[model samples]
Target: MEAATKPKLRVATTSLAGCFGCHMSFLDIDERLFDLVKLVEFDRSPLTDIKHCGPCDIGIIEGGLCNAENVHVLREFRANCKTLIAIGACAVNGGLPAQRNHLSLASILEEVYHAQHGLVDGFIPNDPELPLPLDKVHPIHEVVKVDYFIPGCPPSGDAIWKVLTDLLAGREPELGHGLIHYD
Candidate 1:
């Protein structure tokens, strides 16, 4: 009997408690991205209208979970995706958002818009729909078992391309360490 042909890999990417800059960086791959599309298919991502996790082989998460919603999304992705990659410093180490975590979320909000800025007329509603306070902006590994991480303030398009290529080729995606990461 012949072995079944491996399915073309499906991919999904999402951002959590981040600026969505890394997702833009991924699109900045441009024409080079065309090469990757041939091998893999994109599913649920902020870039796509698709809102829920479908069948996916790889999940590329670009930010850290800073709230209850983020945690829910991460867990959903983890449950669905075969391999999970944490992309960018925010996802890898919480990035700049971690800085604000020094103070309570309410305090930070008040300091920024109410006290110092003097927006007393404005109300800061701590609604359930709003993101919950983060104890700290932790890396993806802190929340879940991430299969891989590409750590950078924002990883370059070339680096993202290389990671995909290496993984597709069935080799360890050597996205460098320290300086030339994954080169």
Candidate 2:
């Protein structure tokens, strides 16, 4: 009889508010992705085009919460995945999106839609189809329990690879000085 092979781990990834730089960095894993594929299966990631996340072994999320939709998705993701990792500065501390924290949402919306010189009768969008905006942007931790955090504006591909590899090997991820970077 042939020996049964171990089931591959299921990994999912998502982005919330900030720019998609972190996902770009993840793609920078480049050729090594082939090796990664052997050990894990992608779930609800952009790479898979799967809209809804199923049960997953690990969920990697980037960006901060900016709207009601973001919170809903993050909560759902947290419920579906056993281990959750918050990646990039936005996920860790709200990053560039949290810059609006100092300003009122109403003022910001007015400045963007009403005061801009583009149109004659611009107004803030109030359509129910749109996700309701939050008064302040918030990090993932503020909304859900996060297991691990990979810091950096968008953590380098090498750092991501290290963390994933360590987790896969059942070892605690350790970012040495060389692997930990902000830029």
Candidate 3:
């Protein structure tokens, strides 16, 4: 009798404070994404158009937490995914967004809005539709336990592929010196 084939792993992904560059890098895998699709199914990712994540085997977070919504999504992913990987410098250490951490939120807001010379009814936005900004941006690990980290301003596609394939094979991922970097 032939051995039964294993089911594809369900994966979820999200971006927080940083740019969606990490997702772009994932897409940089080019034609190899077809191979990834064969190994895993996406849930609650921009690629899948899923509104919310259901039970998932892996979660890939690509940015840092900068607001209440990011916290909510990160917590939700933690609850749903058995293994979570922080991908890119943002998710691993707050990246560029965390640069504002040295300043008070009010000062940062003022610098962006009040300090601007544009003439208008300048006022801090308080729309309910917008997620409330946190006092400071934080890495994903500060909010939830991350099983793995892929370092880089945006990790290269090859680095991401290695991590994914290693996880699928149930082995501890070993990133080479070339792959371990923060830009």
Candidate 4:
């Protein structure tokens, strides 16, 4: 008898306003990444440098939405991915960037461009190529329907691996104790 060949899961990933730490944690899987490839394959990700996402079984998002481009990319992922997972504090709750949400956009811009205490670039940057920042950063769920969340400053590599394996196995992911935290 011959063993059946299981369909490989297609995955896509991206970072928005985040520090890309979640992706780093995913990479922390290190040698386990080889085992992962046996069960899945990347579609659009930093690993592949594929500019656009195609149809994928899972989409892992690693940051908060902070600009027009982020919103656009997130929507594109939602359209192309069957399941979307928000990873890290940034993707779940805007993370470090959300600290600026209390201040108005103008004030933040003024601090960056006109503050006497900082680098004295006298004018606010108005580059046509840059995407405009939103008034506030937002969690992935605010922008799209997130199928799952891996919460942490950056969820540990082991935690991420467990989730991925469980999802691939068609089981609801069981987050063990100490796997999730606010800080």
- Best model per lDDT: 2
Please provide, for model 2 over 92-154, each residue's C-alpha lDDT reduced to its tens digit, 9 standing for 90 to 100.
Answer: 999988999999999999999999888579999999999999999999999999999999988
Two-way lDDT contest, 1 vs 2, winner: 2
- Summarize candidate 1's per-residue lDDT along 137-179 as a digit string, tens digits: 7777887899988877688877787888888888898856542
Each model's TM-score, in the order given? 0.88, 0.95, 0.95, 0.95
Identify the superior model by TM-score, candidate 1 or candidate 2: 2
lDDT of each: 0.80, 0.92, 0.90, 0.91
RMSD of each candidate?
Answer: 3.5, 2.1, 1.8, 1.8
What TM-score does structure 1 among the candidates reach? 0.88
What number of clashing residue pairs does each candidate have, in the order they appear?
5, 0, 0, 0
RMSD of 3: 1.8
Error of 3 at 134 (Å): 0.4
Q: What is the TM-score of candidate 3?
A: 0.95
Least accurate 10 contiguous residues by lDDT in model 1: 174-183
Steric clash pairs (candidate 4): none
Q: In model 2, how large is the Cα lDDT of residue 22?
A: 94
The Cα error of candidate 4 at residue 126, in Å, is 0.9
lDDT of 3 by residue, 41-89 (tens): 8999987779888999999999999999999999999999999999999
Candidate 4: C-alpha lDDT: 0.91
Model 3: how far is 150 from its true place, Å?
A: 0.4
